[model samples]
Target: MKSTVEHLSPTRVRINVEVPFDELKPDFDRAYKKIAQQVRIPGFRPGKAPARILEARIGRAPVLDEVVNAAIPAKYQEAVVASDDVTPIGRPEIEVTEIADHERLTFTAEVDVRPEFELPELEGLTVEVDETEIGEDEVTEQLDQLRARFGTLAGVERAAQKGDYVQIDLSAAVDGTAIEEATTTGFSYEVGQGGLIDGIDEALEGMSADEEKTFTSTLVAGEYADREAEVTVKVTTVKERHLPDADDEFAQLASEFDTLDELTESLRERIGQSKRMEQAGQARDRLLEKLVEGTEVPLPESVVQAEVDSRAHDAVHAFDHDEDKFAEFLATQDKTREQFDAETREEAEKNVRYRLVLDALADREEISVGDQELTERILFQAQQYGMAPEQFVQQIQQAGQLGVIYQDVRRSKALIQAVRAATVTLPGGEVVDLSDLLGDDDADETVEEVPGEVVAESAEDVDGDAADDADTAEDKADAKA
Candidate 1:
């Protein structure tokens, strides 16, 4: 067996391979064994028929066809492995070039390969991040959030207002035809939360208990999705939350602190810490944008197209792949199909660019993700999806997404290394050291005290948040993979 690679472009390669008949003994044996089980012979039991006898019964063409099909993939992989510099990013397009009866088989494969590029000097690459600012108002807002968590809901004998929670019965109709699925009774919703049906919040405000209002709203789902309909809502009850006073007794009840002053001070410190962490996230984002924009990486067209195709598949997947329905959905967002496509292409290009740049950096720097970091990232993703670690692993495995996770972990670690090497400037022109936020050399204490539910979300949430464009492709590609 022999192989040679042709450099078609900076990011692609064509490999020519020739496998002599003697080298295909194993593949031929497997193919014959498989064919023998499917054919009947006078003297031989199933899967025990000799290869010659089976070929005589089924024709040599069928046997050769099976052998070629089975051998091409493994041979292509071998050719790739033999070419030390070739690293394929996607599946190869294999074409069988020739077959000499029982002498040799020849084939060619074209694939997208990672481009060889030089990494920019990591040290001294400067980027600006938002200044960390924790004002008294911000601290007070945190305190209010904490108090709201402990607040009690009480019945209010007045028209509903913003911040009030209400239980309501809702029904909708299109052209006077009632839609049963859109009707719900006793649904509890906050007046200004704004995640429910459109126009619902506006219709709910100023409505007293037992009072009803009929308004127009666009249906977001079901058969009438993206269609306008008239919705009638009746308020069953309105409740206003009564927050505890921000006093010493309340502080003792709500927190580990002993007094209100202590609690306020803790809130201020927590808020300041969160602000700094947010700055770290901004720094990561700015750094990534800078790396992607500043570097002139030659992206593989196939990779970018794969991303674009995956995104397009997902965009219309909700509409059952019906282009007309997707167009309708886009129309509801005031977006033309052309506009959506343009935006998707731009995002896909950025994603491919980011992945290529980071991968190159990772190689040049010999960056590697530790077992602990990989597991932590997996756990964080599972938590994000509300799945247990084992379940998430199984799901990604079934979807062939585990490799994407591995790549994400690697890219994130590589970016962190770059962050540490780069100079991050704050708004006031002070150089911010991200050593603590990005963690120490061993990275055992990478976790920072980010306020509120952010900590529970993920210790590295800030690091990955700013790279969402790249990370989103990883997530979506898992489905495509």
Candidate 2:
């Protein structure tokens, strides 16, 4: 067996492979055994018929066909592995060129390959992020939130307004046909929260207790999804939240701190720490943008198209792959199918470019994802998708996406390395030290567990409000108890 590679373009290659008949003995044997089990021969048990006798009965063409079918995939993989220059990024398009009976078999495979490029000097890169300035207003806002958590809800005689909680009955109909699933009795909602029906907030703004109003909104889910419906909301009761005064007694009631001054100081420190984390995130984004913009990467058309197809498929999958339904769903957002496709393609191109650039940088920096790093990434993703780690691993393995996850982890670490190497400064031109947020230079240390730090967990953890919400909920429960 032999193989040679042809450079079709900077991002693609064509591999020509020749396998002699002697090298194909294993394939031929397996093919014969498989065919014999299916084709019955008199005087021979199933899968016991000799190859020559079976071929004599079925003809040489069938045997050759079976052998070629079984050999191509394995041979193609061998050819790819043998060529160090070919790092295929997408599926190959293979074509069998010739089959000289008793002599040799030949084929050619065209595939998208990773392009080679030199990475720019990362150490010389500089990016500016917003100054980390924790304002008193921010601390006050957090303090107010804490107070609101322990606040009591009291009946109000006035009209419902933003921040007011209301118990309401809702009923909806599409084209005068009532939707049973869309009706709910005694649903409690915050007046200003817009996550419910789109126009409900405005409808409830000036409605007093026992007041009813009818408005039009599009049903986002259920059988009548994406269709406009008449929604009637009746305010059964309106209540306002009364926060306790920010005094020493309130502080003792709300937190571990015994005095309001101590609590205020802690709130200020927490806000400052949060602001610094935000700055670190901004710095990372800016540094990555700079790296991507400063580098030139040849995008593989096939790879980009595959990503675009995947995204488009996911978008329409919920609609059962019905283009018309997807179009109607997009129409609700004031987007046309053409516009959506254009945007999807644009995003796919940008993603592919970003990946290619980061991959090159990873190679230049000799970045590697250890087993522990990979496991940590897998665990994090599993938690994100609300699945057990084992279940997520099985799913990704079935989809052949475990390699994708590995690459993602590698790229993340590479970006972190780039962030560490690049100089980050504040808007005021003062150099910012982000070692606490970016983690130390020790290669064995995982970024997911920075001591007493909140920023270095992961890329998504930088903006993690869920953890903060959980902490707030626990504190509130403790204070109430």
Candidate 3:
């Protein structure tokens, strides 16, 4: 067996392979055995017929066809593994060129390959981040949040207002036809919370107990999804939350603190720590943006298209792939199909670009992900998806996506390395150090799991399933392997 590579472009390659008949003995043997089990020979038991006798009865063409079909994929994988420079990023378009009955078989495979490029010097790069300052108002807001957690709801005799909790019965109709799924009784909702429905907040305001108001809102799900409907909400009860006074007794009840002043001080410190962590996140995002903007990454068209198609598929999946319904859904967001496509393409390009750049950085730094890192990533992702770690692992393994997750973890670690190498500054021109947030070299070597953290800004967060798209592309590319 022999193989040679042809450089079709900076991001693609064509590999030509030739396998001599002697190297195809295993494939021929397997094909003959499979064919023997299906054919009946007079004096021989099932699957006991010899290859030559079976070929004589079934014809050479059938046996050769099965052999070729089985051999091509395995041989293609061999050719790929033999060539160190051919790292395919997309599925190969394979074409059998020739087959000599007793001599050799030849084929050519064209595929998208990772492009080569030099990374910019990370130590010289500089980025600006937001200032980390915890104001009194911010501390007060945190205190209010904590107090609200321990607050009690009491019945009120007045009209419902913002911040009041209301028990209401809701019913809706589209074109005078009742939507059964849209009807609910004794549903408890907070005024101004604004997530239950589109216009329920405004309809509930100023409604006294046992009062009802009819308003119009669009049903976002079910058979009447995306359709405007008349909605009637009857207020069964209205109640307001009452918080305890900020005193020593209340502080002792609410927390381990001895006094209200001590509690307020702790809240202020916690808020300050959160603000500083946010600043670290800002620094990571800014640094990544700078690196990506300054670098030149050659995009692979097939990989980008794969990502775009995946995103588009998901965008329409909720509508059962109904284009008209998807268009209507887009229209609700004031977006045209053309605009959605353009945005999808732009986002796909960015995602592919980010992946390629980080992959290159990881290679340059010789970064490697260990078993522990991979396990930690799996656990974190399982927690995010609300699945057990074993269940998540089984699902990903069944989908052949464990490698894609490994890539994600590797990319995250690479980005943390970039964050440490780059210079980050506050708005006031003071240099900011993220060593504590990023952890030391001797520590866990993982980024902090703060909200809006730097690692969260990666391409995986773009559509929250970009990794799935990448997994699909990788599965296609390495199908034979």
Candidate 4:
């Protein structure tokens, strides 16, 4: 058996293979054994018939066909393994060029493979991060939030206000046809919270208790989604929250701190920590943006198209594969199908490019993900999906996505390495210390910021958002059904 590779393109290759008949003994033996089990002769028991007898009983053509079918995939994989440089990313198109009876077998396989590219140095990348400043306004806002948590609700006689909690009965109909799923009684909603039907907040603001108002809003999650429906909301009762004054007593009641001054100071420290974390996230985003813009990573059209097709399928799957209904749903977002598809393709290309770049960097740097890191990521994802780790793992395995999760974790680790190698600076000319965030506590270590402020971007942000949109759309479709 022999194999040779032809460089069809930077991202594709063709492999030519030749297998002599003498080398196909194992294939013939396996084929004959399999055929013997399937075809039973009167004189011979199953598994005892000779290969020639089996071939004579069935046609020699059938045996040859089975051997060819079984041998192609196994031989193609062997050829791929023999040529280590060809890292195939998609299925190959195989054609048997010649089959000289009992003499030799020849074939060619064309496949899309990962493109060979040079990796850029990550150490010289610099990016700008927002200055972490905990101000009085931020602290006050935190204190206000804490106060609101401990506030008491009292029944009010006036019109419902923005902060007031209201008890209401809501019903809706589209074209005079009642939507049972859209009707609810004695529902408690806060004015201006803004998550319910679109116009509920505006309609509730000036309505007094026992007052009813009818408004038109688009239903988003049910059978009536993307359709305007007339909704009638009747205010049963309004209750205004009365917050305690920001005094020592209130501080003692709200937190572990007994003094309002102590509580405020703690709040400021917490806010500062949160801001620093935000700064770290921004720095990472900026670093990625710089790397993506500065690096010239060749994109594989096949891989990009695969991602685009997957994203588009997931998007329209929620409408029961109805393109027109999906277009209507897009119209609600002020998007047309053409525009949505264009954006999807662009995002898919960016995501594919980032993945390839990160993978190359990981390989060049010899970065590897450990079992603990992979398990931790799995656990985090489980929590996000509100599932137990074991159940999530099972689901991922069922979907054949365990490799995908591993790749994602590896890519994230590679991005982390890039971030560590990058220099981050603030507008005040002070270099920000990201050691705590990066888990490197050495104060003397200096990561020079990028020469200019660069925005960091993540492939996960693009792909994850696409996934979330698909999940949400599917959930809505299920609920409507």
Give the TM-scores of the predictions, in the order they appear.
Answer: 0.89, 0.88, 0.91, 0.86
Clashing pairs in 4: 126-449, 126-450, 127-450, 285-455, 285-456, 286-455, 286-456, 423-448, 423-449
TM-score of 1: 0.89
Q: RMSD for all candidates, in order, please.
A: 6.9, 10.4, 4.6, 8.1
In model 1, the runs with Cα more than 4 Å from the true position are: 332-334, 444-481
Clashes of 4: 9
349-407 per-residue lDDT for model 1 (tens digits): 77777777777776776766677877888888899999999999899776556666666
State which candidate has the highest lDDT: 3
lDDT of 2 by residue, 1-481 (tens): 9999999999988989999999999978998999999999999999999988998999889888878876776676666566666666665666789999999999887877778777779889999988767788888999999999999999999999999999999999998899999899999999997899999999999999999999999888889987899999999999999999999999999999999999999999888888888777777677777877887888888878877898899999999899998988799899998999999998887777777777677777788778988898889989999999999999987654566676677677777788889898877788998788778654532344211111110011001222232222222221221
After superposition, which runs of candidate 4 have C-alpha atoms over 4 Å from their true positions? 43-48, 329-336, 440-481
What tens-digit string does per-residue lDDT give for candidate 4 at 150-195?
Answer: 9999998899999899999999999999999999999999999998
Model 3's TM-score against the true structure:
0.91
How many residue pairs clash per model? 0, 0, 0, 9
Estimate the overall C-alpha local distance difference test score of candidate 3. 0.80
Using TM-score as the measure, what is the rank order of every candidate, best first?
3, 1, 2, 4
